[model samples]
Target: MFVRIVKLSFDPTKIDNFLSNFENQKNSIRNFKGCRLLELYRDKANTNVFFTYSYWDSEQDLENYRNSDLFKGIWANTKIYFNDKPLAWSVDKVVSLL
Candidate 1:
């Protein structure tokens, strides 16, 4: 599996709006082809910082979604609220206790 992690820091005032958008789209995103799992994590000490953790069948599957119109639309809308450029990483498991 391919693990995708995206860390976002939003403008303080835009945090709620950003999270609401995520909530609205979470189901659809998880249902996208080759998607295995999806999760959203918030930093307790920094409310504006959030992380999106997702599992995909492969890098190709993730790229396909990234190239889709759904991604274009969602990303275009989401970027407007960013406080800074977001950080993203694609990874594979080396070890997991769980």
Candidate 2:
């Protein structure tokens, strides 16, 4: 499994718009081919900061999603609300205590 996390910092005034967009696209994104899981997390102390965590079957699968029209639309819309450049990372598990 491949894990991906994208941390985003949005304009406080646009937070609700971002969340609404995410809510509209969440299901389609989760059901994309090779997608295993998806989640949205917001910082407790700063609601404008958030992270999207997802699991994909492989890097190729993730790439496919990235290249899709759905991704293009959603990402473009999301970017409009950003307060700063987003941070994204893909990682392989080395150890799992759980």
State each candidate's clash count: 0, 0
Off by over 4 Å in 2: 95-98
lDDT of each: 0.92, 0.96
| Clash number for candidate 2 | 0
Tens-digit lDDT track of model 2 for 22-93: 999999999999999999999999989999999999999999999999999999999999999999999986
Best by lDDT: 2
Q: Estimate candidate 2's alpha-carbon lDDT, on a 0 to 1 scale.
A: 0.96
Poorest stretch of ten by lDDT in candidate 1: 15-24
TM-score per prediction, in order, is 0.95, 0.94
Residue 77 in candidate 1, Cα distance off native in Å: 1.3
